[model samples]
Target chain A: MENLRLLFDAPILTVQLLLDGILIGAIFALAAYGMMLVWGVLNIINVAQGELVMLGGYVAFFLFKAGINPLFGVPVAAALLFVVGWLLYRVVIFRIVDKDLFISILATFGLSILIQQLAKVAFSPDVRTPQAGFGTISMFGGAVTVTWIKIISFAAALTTGGVLVWFLRGTRMGQAIRATAQNARAARVMGIDTDRVYAWTFGVNAAICGASGALVAMTYLVDPYIGLPYTIRSFMIVIVAGLGNISAVLATAIGLGAAENISAFLFGAEYQIAFVYGLLVVILISRRIVLARQRRYLA
Target chain B: MSTATGKMALALASAALLFLYGPTGATAQTEGDTINLGAAVSLTGKYSVNGKNTKDGYDLAIKRLNEMGGVKVGGKSYKLKIVYYDDESTPARGAQLAERLINQDGVKFLLGAYSSGLTKAIAPITEKYKVPHVEGNGAARELFTEGYKYLFGVLSTSDYYLRDAVNMAAEVAKENGRDPKSMKIAMAFENDPFSLDVRAGILEAAKKHGMKVLVDDKLPPEINDMAATLTKVKAVKPDLLLVSGHEKGATLLVRQTSEMKIDVPIVATTHCDSAKIAETMGKQAEGILCASQWDRTLAYKDKWFGSADDYAKTFQKEFNYPAPYQAAESTASVLVFADAFQRAGSLDPAKVRDAIAKTDVMTFYGPIKFDETGKNTKKPMVLYQVQGGDYKVVFPSKWAETKIKYPRKLPTN
Candidate 1:
């Protein structure tokens, strides 16, 4: 009977952990969704995508200083970043989209360094966050704690993700985008303006990144160097979700979050993040092995 | 062709001599009349808070000094210009920056990096260059033990600050009528060199008091989970919890502990003395105590220390936030440097080092004196508690500008 009671209590904690994970995972999903969309359409990884998110957070923070609510500042950040992204695409990424993959990665990596250094000079290296009340709240038997800004942020991430998923599946423009992803040459031969599509894809991807960054600021504090970690996490999420599947991204996020929570509960909090990174490494290795076998069999 | 080869050989030999044995080292004062100051700081990484603040403080001091007049070098007035480089918080970067500063910038005086790791890494370079270095804000005791006569530090060792907390805790326990010796102490410290030094101080103090150490967990800087550690802490049920780390890491540990329904008398070091803690933790921060050299409410009554009140006011007016330890260290560094400059009576690096080694300067905090080893003498420690979303100094009743209502629990409006 005592064991039964303990077992029953575990579910409440587990569910509470899951909810916390889902809300936090929503932000990760949004971050990964942008990566997927850009890679699918433009065939460029957008290495500086995390910095775009960081830039968006800074934009929203400043706008908040200008007496605008951070939530309201989200679209403003996205719009401004859209222009920035459009320029970057036109000047930098646009030229290299046709270049070799290695060259494109290297160029974007250089762009990341430039953006990071500029951010370091412009924004004081000290961290800043919007004044959002994110105190804990109790729900059910187990307490679910999150910032109010994070609650709103998670909702926004989910809404954006849902809308993007719908657009990709249902819209005519999204269809053209998918067609271009499948075969860019064929799509171009069929009268699609592939270059324009690529440009729009870059802007849209940046907008997603900007919005995600704006939302992330409510949950996490950002220093100038937060870009590298965000980039690593996004890459991990994308790889874990198995490339292009948005649904799989969400699933992987939930699993990753729950694993961190469990690790926190079992081990010291220091090891919780280590658990996620470890999982990412293991997943990638096993996936590589599986791919190698498949290639060998095909040969 | 043979005559040309001989001329080329002569030129190459001269270049090698200059490169291997510094050409500029021979000249006591160059035609440029410039005294180069080498600085390596984390102007871009996580430690940039103190790094950039130190830079700003150094600049402000230089600006004020030059405006008043220039540093007297020989008989001529030499304007001070710092040749600072970003170390990026990496050892290799620190060494490289140090090399560039000494070899390229021709800096005769060096200021060590913000953290102890960077400081220790660049110490060899300073030795190699034979330049006098003033260690800025890197509080590890190992820097002092390096046996380098050129390296002089202005800040008190982390051991001194951490010991201040343990001593204050003992006093608090005795005042509360608990047998101080019987008190079980649990300590959680960041795994960084600063916190390790602090932990060593705590252990030394604990042994002095014969107090029982129930739990000792040293955590890394990037710990995202602390629940298990807290669980161990709860099992031990120590009378006091000494949690130490950077701002976010400390705050997260406290928050996680609260979520686990673990509440004990928690005392943190200067790392927790910021508006960031109260803003993030809210009610969870209540009753949490800490010790620092300066608090915002310090009245500028002491003439020797200048005006902490004015400094605080100016900082807040400019930054739109309360001045934390970073600002305090910056202001303190400037005050120490200026005092040393005055006592030295010249911009000669050796003389300045000698002056800093010997002179006692009155500053905003109090009468500042450095012993031969370069730790601050007469360091006044203030104890503070988070009371209803505000940090109030309540201990050492002489300086208790405000009373902290202790054991303040949750649902405190």
Candidate 2:
């Protein structure tokens, strides 16, 4: 009650919360975009989405250590992760691509653990941040503060989303991917090498995660186990946005981020995660209810 | 052919039996010239960093003790050796490993796991088995409240971690000519056994001083951001901001507080050294007060490690990193076991348990005197302020390296 009154009394805090939420949400949306693509095209949940992001952050971290600016590490990480995703698709993900959803979930979950453990061994379990040196921007006489790295992340997310839309609409490979997503068998019959398409789709998804992860490393600290939360957040955002809706995924991710921030402010940080999972439950139940009503109407 | 085959099979059967029972027999509390201690520490997973520290502390103590001709028991010298199993940082695994160490390996004496949660899980098993367990890492107050006679902790309870910070804030408030009762405290603690216990301690201290708790937020274990909580801090403008969430909590609190520039009069936290904030975050970590179990500069000396500074130096040379309090207290736990072994003059667990109960010793870590509840009553938690890229002790005037930097000036970068 006191916190709610404080929000009303000092509304600038609301702006700060929302701005932070939106900036963070943009990265969440970027991860979700990759998840949405893999879910739609490859029919795999890609539970290792967060691991890819974690690996991407490590890439930027190493680059920073090597005396390269982490800002340039964004594209480099994406490119490297693209190859990693392609190899992973060939080695393991390909076997589960055509399997049941449950099988894919279990397989990818195992992959997530494998990647996390390997990263732990390779990088050690230390919370690390690649210093972007972007500094902070104060607004309204320092009443609201925004980190420059976060703004860069926000801009990167937007640009990636725009580029993703253009790629899917303009390129011939994009049309082939769309066709495969619509009907793999039909696309295969039309001489569209659907196997390559699936591999590319998975690779592209990982690249997106890599880019988001670089931004995340610059914005917040990254650790080996930090990937699971990003996976959960991306999964939630994809569910709320639905499959194949790029704009909706972006908007819902931002909205979820804002709602999480506001709810944390009102309910205390202890309930922040509880609130997220609770909202997931509510969204799922309401959707089921609406579907049930439609079935009744049909009957 | 039947006679020769039967003879060979009989010999092989006897050999297999010997192979199985030989190792179990050797794993007894005392083997020949070595005293074996069993420990289940985190070698992997979330607590691995601290787990490694605990293991190193134990190893360093064992190495030093062995070099000094080991512990003299019953008119003979016995070297110390530890049988270790990786707990994987899970409470269930820790409990299971404790049972395995006791039942299967026949390890009579046990050392502790890393965190309080794992310790809490293993404590019941040790109590059930009548094994003497001495630990340095697990510091939750609830562990002491459980009435486990066999579980002796060398470190102060978790609640004491941030309590001194709260008291210091109150003192600062009074010094500034403001009513201490009018002060508001905002706390963000990780929702874990250890951190919540720290929160409880801070709350008690705040209540005793008649301070209002404006924001008591429980951060999720997987939290990467606390912007929402910080936003509330901005609005409420609490007199003091207290955060306790282990390494991640300390790191995030320092980073976000600087990024958001949420300037409260006092900002205090735990795990600043473990998180390496002074070294990594540098200018941003300046003026932030951190609660610690032990600091290298303390005037504590012992026969084994000489002084606290000497122990830290040896540890850094061995481990390639500065020894956090986790490692210090862990080393102290090993020292406690060695002392008990020497005093009891026996290899029996019950005798060692009794000796450990009557422990009144001073070491490089601190004077460790456990009360009836297995809680160390002699040690006081210290507070450190990050000054010019180093942790300088600024509280508990006896060991003060420097005076407290008042009101924590925000870096003008």
Candidate 3:
């Protein structure tokens, strides 16, 4: 009650919370986009989505340690993760592609644990942040503080979203992927080489997550265990936006981010995660009720 | 041919039975001339870093003790060895591992885990089994209040960790001619046992000094950002900001406070050394007060590690990192165990427990004197201010190495 009144008393804090939320939401959107891509195209919910992001962050961290500016790590991390995604598809994802959704989920869940353990062994379970050296930009007479790295992350997320949209709409491979997502057997009959499309789609999703991970490493910090929260957040965002709805994903991500920050400010930081999971429960229940009213249970 | 096959099957079944039940049934707390201590530490989870430090502390002590002719018990020299199991930093796993260590491995003595939560989980099992458990890491006052006779600690309870910081803030406020009662505090503590205890301690101090609490937030364990809390701090403009969420909280608080340009007069937290804030964050970490159980510069000494500085040097040579207080206190825990073993002159858990309860010794970390509730009563928590890229003790006047820089200057980007 007191916190709510304080918000009204000094409205500038709302601006700070919203700005921080929106910036953080941008990175969340990027990760969610990758999740949506893989879920839509491959029909496999990649539980390992966060681990890929974690690996990308490690890539950026290592690059930073190697004396390279981490800002350049976005592209390098994306490129490297593309190969990792391709290899993962060829080795394990291929078998689960035609399997049950539950099977895919279990497989990816195991893969997530494996990746986290491997990263722990490889990188050491230290909370690491790459110094981006991009200082803060004071706004509204220093009432609101914004980090330059966060602004860059927001821009990078938008650019990546734009490039992803263009790739799907303008490129031939993108069309093949879209077609494969729609009707795999039909696309295969039309000479789409559906397997290659699946591989590329999965790779592209991972590359997107990788790019976002580099942004995360620069803006915040990363550790092996940090991946699960990202995975859960992206999952929530994707489910809310519905798979493959890029714009909705972006909007929902930002909204969720702002809501999280405002809720944390009002309810205390302990409720921040509770607010997220509570929102997820509410969304899921409301969707179910709406579907029931239509006399159709959700599949 | 059938008789021969049946005889071979019988032989195989007998061998398998022996393999399954032999070692467990015969296992003893002491094997020949060696005393076994069991520890379930976090080797693969969030607390892994501190867990590793705890393990290193135990290992170094055991190695040194064995080198110095081991513990003389019952007119016999016995080597000390620890059987370790990874608890994965979960309470359930810790409890299960504690059971396995006692029931299966037959470990009569137990050492502490990294965090208060893990120790809380394992303590009951030790108490039930009547095993003498001595720990240095678990400092939550709640642990001592449970009145577990077998549980002995070598470090001060969690509340003491930041009590001195609050007192110092009040003192500074009074010295500056400001009404200490008018000062406001903002606290952001992790929603865990240890940090919450620290919060309770600060709140008690604030209430006693008649200071107002502007903002009290509980940081989630996996928290990576503090924008909401900081935003509140900015709006309320509190005189002091107290944060405690272990290493992650320390790192984030130092990093974000600078980025946000928060101008709180005093910023104090726990786990700055464990987080390596002075070294990693450097200028941004300056002027932040840190609560620590021990520092290498303290003029504490014992037979095994000599002075605190000597123990730190030895630890660095072995582990290749400066010994944080987590490791230092852990080493102290082992020293307490060794002392108990010598005094008891036996491996009986009851005798050892009594010996531990009567412990009043000094080691490289600090003096270890357990009160009635199994918490160390002698050790005083030290406050370190990060000054010029180093941690300088600035509190508890008798042990103070330097004066505190008041109204901390935030680094200009």
By TM-score, rank the candidates, best first.
2, 3, 1
Best model number under DockQ? 2
The per-residue C-alpha lDDT of model 3 at residue A217 equals: 86
Segments of candidate 1 deviating more than 4 angstroms: A1-19, A74-76, A139-151, A264-269, A288-299, B1-138, B148-154, B179-191, B202-264, B267-291, B295-364, B367-374, B377-380, B383-400, B411-413
Query: Candidates' TM-scores?
Result: 0.70, 0.84, 0.83
Q: How does each model score on lDDT?
A: 0.69, 0.90, 0.90
Q: What is the C-alpha RMSD of each candidate to the true structure, in Å?
A: 7.8, 5.6, 6.7
Interface RMSD of each: 5.4, 1.0, 0.8
Worst lDDT run of 10 residues, candidate 3 chain B, spans B18-27
Summarize candidate 3's per-residue lDDT along B344-367 as a digit string, tens digits.
988788888899899989898888
TM-score of chain B of each: 0.79, 0.83, 0.81
Ranking by lDDT: 2, 3, 1
All models, DockQ values? 0.11, 0.60, 0.55
**Stretches > 4 Å off in candidate 2:** A281-299, B1-134, B302-306, B311-327, B330-361
**How displaced is residue B369 in candidate 3, in Å?**
3.6
Native-vs-model 3 lDDT?
Answer: 0.90
Task: Say what the interface RMSD of candidate 1 is.
Answer: 5.4
Candidate 3 vs. true structure, TM-score: 0.83
